[model samples]
Target: MDKKEDKHKVAEEPMEHTLDCMSRLETMSDEEWNEFFSDKNSMSDCSFLLGYKEAKLRKEAIKPNAEKAWQHFHTSYIVPETTRRHMGIWIYPLATIAAILAIVFILKFVHLNSSDIDVSRPFMAFTADHAPQLITITEDGSRPNIIEGRQQRDGILINDKEADFTHASFAKKMIRSIATPRGKSYKIILNDGTMVLLNAESKLIFPTSFVGKQRNVRLIGEAYFKVKHDTAHPFIVQTEKVNTRVLGTEFNLRAYPTSDTHVTLISGSVIVCNRSNNKAIKLCPGQDATLLGNKDFDITTVDTDYYVQWKDGYFYFDDLPLVEVMKELGRWYNVDIEICDNSLLSYRLHFIAERQASIDQVVENLNGFSYLSATRQGQKIIISKKMHLKSD
Candidate 1:
């Protein structure tokens, strides 16, 4: 019979018998499975069996009969060569049986464990090993109250702790602060439902409640904002060099003191105003506006993915200068990167790496390039150009 006819014949067999064979295969020993796979002659048979099992599975949503899928495996895959020749029963190759068994096992495992998955957890690109601090700033400049894991009804939550601002004594003290140190990032939801993801070495200060017409927050480093829609109470973010005002929008604001202020809009709309000069410019989605000292805004259309991927758990670089790439890595890893040679700074590269990866893994990937060399010493990363040996 041809391959089609063979598959149909197997499918026509009693479902109980097919299931029994699977149960036995699940119980087979590792040595027996290795022996079947090692037999080169049985390769085709294994493929055929695998295809048959997949077809049957697609036709019916049948669950495996075994509790522990692997425990039910058996050694009925092959009979001795002499016993098969003497008996009338057709001998099926062990390799095919093993392949079929693997498919059924995987299906069963998935089916049984599906309910254990958590669906409500939010996805984050990276989490700092060190926790950020939450403090309430008083007008008197007294020692700030350091808040940790606690939650209060109708108040803000920091880490796990919640601050009760409803009390009369603390209600007047509206200023609250969240500070993220090097190698750490923090996330918080303001009273107005605005979600902010604070980047490393960043500080955000805002009122405990939105009592005024404008909801204002001051930012120091880098942060991603998802402002809640409130036309009456417009949201405003004050950076060192610029102020971003938005009704309801998602955007990333990079205002590190050492770098130029950048506002990259992801959705809705925003107006960026230079702090030095009140000149303002409107930005639409997929556009980046940078404030250059006291000059007018420099607006440019950019790939939004490159700016916002940091919050989603990745370091995305698209033909960026190697020096800029190292600078970003330094912020999240809490390390200083020193370029021993200036020639390597001009080299542009496109790279993507998981934010949670270790610094060692990052260095290893950088060294993979033939012309670049990277090494880690204590908490510092040293970069240098690779010297190639001339072939005579």
Candidate 2:
């Protein structure tokens, strides 16, 4: 064989073991992963395994050129004259290491361009179906940090350790935002001991530390708030259509951009005032007040359980319209629901199911209703009216 052929050779045994080690790592716990990589004897194995994983993940996205990768490895090292004489024996491992280096460079380029937040942007917008993000906005700019898989803390703890954030300047008028993408939810405790459970597709923007008299927060989606009772400082939740002010209370506020603003009081009294007309309504326990867009509130008594079931991992629908029911299901499943027949939109549904149930199971239960027909297509659900024969 020519010298060129020997230089490009690869060791099949190491390549095969790389795949096996990655498969085992997939099922390992944090401690197991650390222990596996800490062994000095396995240092070489760990490097190759990590490089292979990164390359494999970005294979389609990067579409790296084999010629370029080989060229990179070729220029990075010089084989000594003595080593050239035994090139066939050692060239394979050297060639493999060169390829891994190329893969790492491709990943680094992608990270700098896409994942890292730009210093000029005010906030980072995350896409659907990903983990929640905790963003901090300072006078300089904004930095979006993934709540999961991050070690550094900036002065906030999510669920006592699942995620952490801490920065010395966090106390000084710093703004923090917690955003949860579709099909995901997050619970965070504020500096004032108030607990907030953010629903899917929601964003809560607040200060890292409560300053001034009132503890204020702006919500762009749904969240269940259990405010800490401090009569001196009233807790205020601002939304697009209305502002909910309470001294101390437990309530769920749903303020999705596309949906009507709803403030359902579970315990404690809250005054919800319309942003447009400044009209206000005081909500008692078990009362739901919906902003009707004309600065009017449609206040009614409701089963408080129906409003909070999402917080507790349940989908509880009590005499809710079929369209509204489908909307809730769509948010949780990250699927789009289309009513094939417009008439089915007004059909009232009384259903209760666990959020953990498979989408197929939930769809099957919906199909059990005599007047409803439901079918699931990849990432979309079609609901139509079921035809029934009249008795002769």
Full-model lDDT for every candidate: 0.67, 0.68
Per-model TM-score on C-alpha atoms: 0.61, 0.61
- Compose the digit string of candidate 2's lDDT tens values, residues 249-321: 9999999876778899999899999989899989999999988744689999999898899989999999876
Which run of 10 residues does model 2 get worst, by summed lDDT?
A: 118-127
RMSD (Å) per prediction: 22.9, 24.7
Model 2 spans > 4 angstroms off: 1-143, 150-152, 159-171, 387-392
Which portions of model 1 show Cα errors greater than 4 Å? 1-147, 151-154, 160-170, 389-392
**150-204: candidate 1 lDDT, tens digit per residue:** 5454343344322233331345546767777676677767777788888877888
